[model samples]
Target: MQVYKAFFKIIQKNRGQILIYLVVFMVLALLLTNTYNPPQDTDFSKVKVNIAFINNDSDSQLVAGLKTYLDENANLVDLPDDTQKLQDALFFREVEYILRVPAGFTEAMLSGQNVQLEKTTVPDSTSNVYMDLLINKYLNTAQTYTTYLPGLSQADLTQYLARDLAEQSEVTLISNGSHSANAEKSGYYFNYLSYSMFAILILGVSSVMLVFNDTDLKRRNLCSPIRSATINFQMILGNLSFAILTWLVLISASFVMYGSFMFTPPGMLLLLNSFVFTLAALSISYLIGNLVKSRGAMSAVANVFALGTSFISGVFVPQELLGDNVLTIASFTPTYWYIKANNEIAAAVSFNADTLQSIFTSMVLVLAFGVAVLAVTLVLIKQRRVEA
Candidate 1:
């Protein structure tokens, strides 16, 4: 009990470092929440742009029909037939494009003569590109009709063009049949747990270990009446208590941000993956604590390992975008498997054998990593005891 109390007393002295990591994690969580909106799906819609039509030619059935077509596809703005107004309209973005049908434009098309229609728009305008396509679509279809059916009247051509262009096939967006959006949002939050948990656990655990490993302190503990086993058990309990509380704080914050998403099946799996990773983080902290003799060395090792592994393990960047050589090395680390599991959980909608096995296998691998590191740390500690 005394050792357990002492373990936390050492941590209280180092609370500033923990608060820094906690605040950083909170900022990161807020950013992730903003970035991962649930309604990522957007429906397809035809883009319509505002445009002005100038008919320099007398009204004819063909020109009238073309104007009608443009009206349907775009917002036709009316401006005074003045040069300044037109230029100002274009500059101010009130109109993205303008079409000027020159006199005798209809006659040129029926007689197989090419007439370039005057146009105005800003340079490199994307809306104008779509407008060009629309204009070309109508004229090109008109040209085809006149070439093959020269006897066809302008009225017939317009009628046929409308009918041909009117037919459209069905368009829709496909979905993954589950709460993929929510899963994705939660996934990002969990994926970020790696770096935060690693840094916090390392600094907290190692600092306490360093204090307890002080030579004068260790000699006093060894000579005390209390059994060594009780001290060791209390120390282990204190460390576990600290680690679990850290994990709970992070989980509670997520619950506040994401609500019941933290309790959903996939969300629960995300929690499980992160919990296993927390264990892995604890093991590494234990190992580093036993090895590093100074606070400065502990801080350096914590940052280097936490940031370096996060970079290679798909925390800062996705594993897919990382170089193959980098991934080959990262695969050796437990964080890589943890991230892989998070991604899989986000994409998954069902708990079929294949999906469950995939997620569980990743958890097992991460747990195995923690077990291996913890075993090594224990071995090192035992060797030190024998030497003493």
Candidate 2:
């Protein structure tokens, strides 16, 4: 048909652009896929943390005992009596934790007064957790010692240790372990998703451009012998080709980056889900082209719709952060369904009858959207022909 011929001409002229876009997309996809390094599940050894303790009182025996205990279990450092130097070391992160003993720490412990031992450590450090466990261990040891003493009761020693030091021991955990490996992983995930969705802008722009192109060139085609439907069909095929190409690039990238052996058969399900999502994009793009006559105007609208919907749908950020209103609206977006499906597959959620049914639902919705767009475009063409 005349329309098919025209389409061939356009393809020949624009082959370069298609190739360039394909290559760029492929590279980006590979980079993202390669970055996905899942944490290994094993009993990993913990990092060593250095700790400094300053004894205020001359409790040589108590200090020696404590130092020996810590040195055996943890990396303990004895610092100068200078308080300012200890503070500087803490600020510099040279030590994971610092402990301070009052002037009468040893005397208080001997006098059966409640001794207040101070413990300091980097805030949120796994070291802090370990330190707490060690302190509890020391307490248990002291209780065992008291049980053997004829006159000393466990409570008596505990009270004496506290009163002698003026109060019970207070542990202060203080540096920067706020962000863990898992947190870093989350950041990477968000960044990858953000970049991936950014590419959707191309889809929007191309859709709008195609719409305007049809409106502008349609009159010229009407004068020729080719049926408009045939021309439209060619265009539709081109769009399908582009969508399929993009999906393949993404899947291939994942394989290249993670190694072909990483993703198993079930993992392939995520790729399939992503492919289904592309059909949704195709339908929406076709609808936009048929509805909008001005390329520039449609481009502007496309940007707004794509960005707004993607943001609200958790493509740009975590879906959990979005409130009920934004979340409720996001469900209507095709991107939401696909995103959800991708996540579910990644997490390896149980694949039951419900999941199969949901997949069928997604496919149905996408098919329906494509059919609607085709119907609308036909109606518009008929109207234009009648007017002419």
Candidate 3:
């Protein structure tokens, strides 16, 4: 009880550092949520291209139909035929495409001869390519109709083509039990939350260990009536209590931020995954605390482990953007599994064997890592005691 109480007192003394990390976690969560808010539903069918057209063809039904098609698909703007004016419009992005229907365009189409329309635009323009595709589709449909429906008069042909081209088909998109908008946001929030957990656990536990490792305090504790094993057990219990408190605080914050969504299956899985990762983090911190002798050295180790793993494991940058080589290296760290599991949970629509298997695999790996590090910590502690 004395050792446990003393351990907690050390943690209480470092509460300011712990509180700073907590505050940072909440602030970052809010900032990321606002910055990456999901886009609202939009009507894409009404989108139009901005274009400038130069129609030099004579009065003919075919040319008239082409003019109508261009007007319907694009926002037609009038600009003078002056070279400088056209160049200025192109340079300023006032129009995506500048099209010229030459004088013989109508005659060539009517006579069944292939003719190419001239287009002018700035270099490497993506909108220009899209506009070009639309133009080609309209002209190709008109040409095919003229070739097959030769019996129709010019006016009827033009009217039929216009009606046919104007028709639009409706499309509906459906989700197959995958993640929702809220789930995606939650994933990102938790991915970043790992950094806070790592820093708090390492700094908190290492600070306690530093106080216990004091030579005078250690000699006094050895002279006391308490068994060394009993003292060690109490210290372990205290560390576990501190870790649980930190985990609960973070988990509660997530629930407050996300509401009932945190109770969903995917959400629960995210929490569970984070819990496993927390255990791994605790074990690693314990190992570090045992190895490092000074508070300054402990702080340096905490910063390196926390920030370095966070950046490499996709907490700071998305996993999708990380290079394969970087991911390959990050795979050795627990944060990688933590983020990977969160991603899988966020993307899954329903809980199934496959989902369970994948998540469990990561959980087992995290646990394994914790157990391995804990074993090493115990061995090192035993070796140090023997040396003493």
Instruction: State which candidate has the highest TM-score.
Output: 3
User: By TM-score, how accurate is candidate 3?
Assistant: 0.85
The positional error of residue 289 in candidate 1, measured at the CA in angstroms, is: 1.4
Model 3 lDDT tens row, 173-250: 775664568788899888988999999999999999888888898899999999999999999899888888898888
In terms of lDDT, model 3 sits at: 0.86
True-structure Cα RMSD, model 3? 3.3
Task: Evaluate all candidate structures by whole-model CA lDDT and list the values in order.
Answer: 0.89, 0.58, 0.86
TM-score of 2: 0.60
Tens-digit lDDT string for candidate 1 (143-183): 99888888789889889988887777887767546665668
Runs in model 1 deviating more than 4 A are: 1-41, 56-58, 80-84, 102-104, 112-116, 178-192, 215-242, 256-259, 296-388
**Highest lDDT scorer:** 1
Worst 10 residues of 1 by lDDT: 36-45
Which ranges of candidate 3 are over 4 A from the true structure?
27-45, 146-153, 176-185, 213-229, 343-361, 385-388
How well does candidate 2 score on lDDT at residue 255? 54
Candidate 3 has its poorest 10 consecutive residues by lDDT at 38-47
The backbone clash count of each candidate, in order, is 0, 17, 2
To one decimal, what is the Cα RMSD in angstroms of model 1 from the true structure?
Answer: 5.1
